[model samples]
Target chain A: MTYCLGMLLKDGLVMISDSRTNAGLDHIAVFRKMTIWNEPGDRVIVIAAAGNLAITQEVIHFLHVGVTLPDEEEPKTIMSVTSMFEAAQLVGAAVRRSYRIDGERLEKENSGFNCSFLIGGQVGGDKARLFQVYSAGNFIESTADTCYFQIGEMKYGKPILDRALSYDTKLTQAGKLALISMDSTLRSNLSVGLPLDMAVYHRDSLELGMHRQFDEHDPYFAEISQRWSKSLKDAFLALPDPSW
Target chain B: MTYCLGMLLKDGLVMISDSRTNAGLDHIAVFRKMTIWNEPGDRVIVIAAAGNLAITQEVIHFLHVGVTLPDEEEPKTIMSVTSMFEAAQLVGAAVRRSYRIDGERLEKENSGFNCSFLIGGQVGGDKARLFQVYSAGNFIESTADTCYFQIGEMKYGKPILDRALSYDTKLTQAGKLALISMDSTLRSNLSVGLPLDMAVYHRDSLELGMHRQFDEHDPYFAEISQRWSKSLKDAFLALPDPSW
Candidate 1:
């Protein structure tokens, strides 16, 4: 299992993902789940994936090579996409292609075809966009009313995002919200472990504004995790008891 | 769908459950998921269930009557059980009997035999206890190290419990923790709904100490929910931002 989420805010986009995957407890391993495609001033697309590692890797491979659509003069890669919407289409097509090859085999083995992706970034002059692409290759774009998308092991961290995020949030604050959400998940679930990859995109910059990895000992994350826990306990203790 | 949790604490026991069940989004209804059997001064057992309503109801009926063991002189009901452990076994036996009658047929229809329970309380001289009974009726008791168990739609509400609960927590504090946990689930998932049923048992008393139902309009619950949200937002804001 994995946990990946992305926010589409007024100033830009924030994408975050944990780097733990496992077939079972004994087979746990670390695998980076976020991929960044940077083409300088033209486009900067960040994709975070969760689900079967093999399937996700195949989809990523397909995207790296390029995705061909019917009637298209040539294959379109993330770097070549004209808009964020087109980039999402390219990723969805790759997911469908991988499904076409492996879905039947997985079904026969009683292993469900489970994979999903969060695609968010800017392309040329288009505004930053966020989308959640499902296992079936279909997708839904996030709007101001729903400015974020989460995939895999999502429930544990969702209440925070539901209460804290909005489309108008500043890029820096959005990044903090994303980390706080991830911190909640890491504490509760072993399937989602650390060494997180995050990309903070500033709208119209077309450059990877800030991309960093948080390991188990990263000081800032350590501070956030410890301080958040203490603050929650303090806050919980402060609430007036039910006047029963 | 539902969310129910029980904590076995040093002072007593705390049990909380939501009152919503649904076949789908359109077919939701309010059905109390908790039941209490108190032979005051002798035994007090609170049972909270989650999963197929029909199956859980049948199991409750069986427990109401009695469950026969191969060597027992007669069927044993919760009221007649010798210990909290025995009472748990009685409930498990009832669950198995219900499964014998319906599990195969449910599987034939692809509905799947899905159900689980949390049983907690005290009997006679026995200490307060908590057990999580699985769909198969097998159960494991909570100890000083792990004193709480959650059944059904549990993840969204679990982090708070993990961070706040301990066996030494007072019964009142445990009740507050349970409500905080339930509040998070209610905000994050539509399946787990309001009008929560809660019971606070004081050890050695052997009777139901405090039992209450919190509806959507319940004043105290409303205050707790509102205050908790505000506290979380404030806590998040207090955390130092990533120095990147």
Candidate 2:
């Protein structure tokens, strides 16, 4: 299992993904789940994937090689997409390719075709966008009413995001929210482990300005995790008890 | 769907269950999920169930009518169970009976034989106990290391319990924790709704000292829900920002 989330904020976009993947408790492994396709000043597409590692990797491979859209003479990679919406379409096409290649085979082996991606970034002058691409290769773009998307092991961390985030939230604050959300998930779920990848896309920058990986010893993440836990406990204690 | 949780604390037991049951989002109804068998001074058994409402109701019915135990000369009722463990076994027997009556019929209609239970209370001289009974009629007791059991839509509220709860927690504190946990789930999930039933059994009392139902207009629950949201937001803001 994995957990990946992205927010399409008015100022920009924030994306975060956990690196741990496990087929079972005994077969746990660490593998980076974030992929960035960047052409500075032109387009910067950051995607975080969760679900079957093989399927997500295959989808990423197709995106890298360029996926062909129907009626289009040439294949278009994330770098070639003219806007964030087109980039999401390109990602969706790659997901479709992965399904075509592996879905049936996995089903035959009694495995469900499980894989999802959080695509968020800007293309040239287009505003930063966020989308949750489904296992079926269909996708839903985030809007003001729902500015964020989360896939895989989402429930544990969702209440915080649901309560705290909005489309107009500051980019840096959004990044912090994403980290806090990830921290909650990491603490509650063993399948979602450490070494997270995060990307912060400033609005209209068309460049990946801040892409960082946080390992166990990363001081800032460590601080956030520790402070958040302490703060929760403190907050819980401060609440008035039920009158019996 | 339903959300019911029980905690076995050194001071006593805390059990809470939401009152919503839904066949689908449109077919939702308010149905109490908690059952209490109070033989005050002798035994106090509280059971909360989740999953197919019909199946759970059926299991409760079997328990009320007295369920036949393997090789037993007479059926055993929850009121007659001598120990907390036997009360759990009696509940499990009811689950198996429900399954025997409805499992194949539900399967034939493409529905699952889904249901689970959280049983917690003290019986006679036994220490306060907690067990999570499964659909298969098998059950697992809570221990010092893991003193809480939550069945149905559990993930949304689990992080708090994981971080804050332990066997040594006071019964009242555990009740507060359970309420906070339920509040989180109620906020995050539509299926787990209001009008909750809560039971707090104090150690060695062997009586149903506090069993109350909080409806939508309940002031205490409303206060907790509103204050918790505010407290969480305050806690989030108090955390340090990412050192970007």
Candidate 3:
């Protein structure tokens, strides 16, 4: 299981991903689920994927090497795309390429070719956009009403984002919300662990302002985790313990 | 969809269930998910069901009507059971009866005969026990270590329970926690709605207390929901905002 979230706020895009993947509890590994493509000042795209690591990696590989469309003679890659939409299309096309190759074999073996990505970036002149790209190679863009997308182990961390987030939220605030969300998920699920890859992109800056790694002992996160737990308990105690 | 949770604490049992049942979002109804069989001073059993309304209704009806186990010619039921374990078996047997009659037909129709129940109560000298009876009719008792069971739309409300609950929690406190859990779920899911049925049974006390229906305007619940939401927001805002 994994938890990845991408927020497209007025100030910027906030991306957070937990770096734990497991075939089973005993087979756990620290697999970074986040991928960043940066041509600083020109384009910066961050993609976080969860589900079927093989399929996700293959899609990324396809994106890296480029893929020729079903009827087209030439290949289009993320690096070669003109718009963020085109970049999303290229990523989706790569997913399709992976489907064409191993999807059937996986199904034959009773394994799903499951994968999804949260893609966000700015290219050339258009404002930054964020999308949730699905395993089927289709995607949906985030609008003002829905300024965020979460993939994998989503439910456990969703309430906070649903209640507190909006496009106008400050980048730092959005990052804090994202961490709080992640903290909730990590506390509830063992499948999602730390050594988080968090990147905060300032809308038109096209540069990652804060791309940091967080482990179990990361001071700020530890403080937030401990503090959040204490705050919640304190809050629970502060509530009138039912008079029933 | 539904959301029901049963927690067995050192002080007692906390059971909460939402009454919203929907064949689809277009076909919604308020069918209470909770039922209680209390023969004061003798036994008390609370059952909460989720999934396949028809199947759940049939199972409950079977329990309501009592069942004669094969080879044991007597028709024993929750009211007749002398121990919580036997009461759980009666509930399980009721589920199996529903399966025996309609499972195949539903399977043929591609609609799963799925339903689960949380059965918790005390009978005679047996301490209060909580069992999560699955669709297969097999059940697992809630031990001190794993003290809670949730069926349907559970994740959204899981974090608070994971953090705030312990075996020693008072019945009223557990009830408050359950309501808070339900409040979180209601905010996140439209399918799980109001008019929740909450039952908090203290150990050794066969009579039910604080059994209430929390509708849109139910005053006590209104206070709980409002205060709880405000506290969460206050706590969230109080958490250190990101420095980056």
User: Per-residue lDDT of B1-244 in model 1, one digit per residue for the tens?
Assistant: 9999999888989999999999988999999999998778888899999999999999889888889754677898777888888888887888888889998999999999899999999888988889988988889999999989999999999999889889899888889889999999999899999889999888889899999999989888899899999999999888887777
Poorest 10 consecutive residues by lDDT, candidate 1 chain B: B69-78
Candidate 3 per-residue C-alpha lDDT over A126-237 given as tens digits, one digit per residue, 9 for 90 to 100: 8899989998999999998889999999988888777778788888888888898999999899999998999999889878778888898888898888898898888887
Question: After superposition, which runs of candidate 2 have C-alpha atoms over 4 Å from their true positions?
Answer: none
Worst 10 residues of 3 chain A by lDDT: A68-77
How much is B176 displaced in model 1, in angstroms?
0.7
Per-residue lDDT tens digits for candidate 2, residues A1-244, read 9999988888888889999999878999999999987788888889999988889898888887899975687998776778878877887888888888888899999898988889988777777788888888788999999988899999999988888898888888888889989988998899998899998888788778799999999999988888888888888888787779
Q: What are the per-residue Cα lDDT tens digits for candidate 1 across A94-142?
A: 9888988999999999898999999999888888899999998889999
Identify the candidate with maximal DockQ.
Answer: 1
Candidate 2 residue-wise lDDT, B34-133, digit = tens: 9998887898889999999889988998888899876787998887878888888888889888888888999899898999999888887777889999
Between the candidate structures 1 and 3, which one is better when assessed by lDDT?
Answer: 1
Ranking by lDDT: 1, 3, 2
Model 2 DockQ, alpha carbons vs. true complex: 0.81
DockQ of all candidate complexes: 0.83, 0.81, 0.73
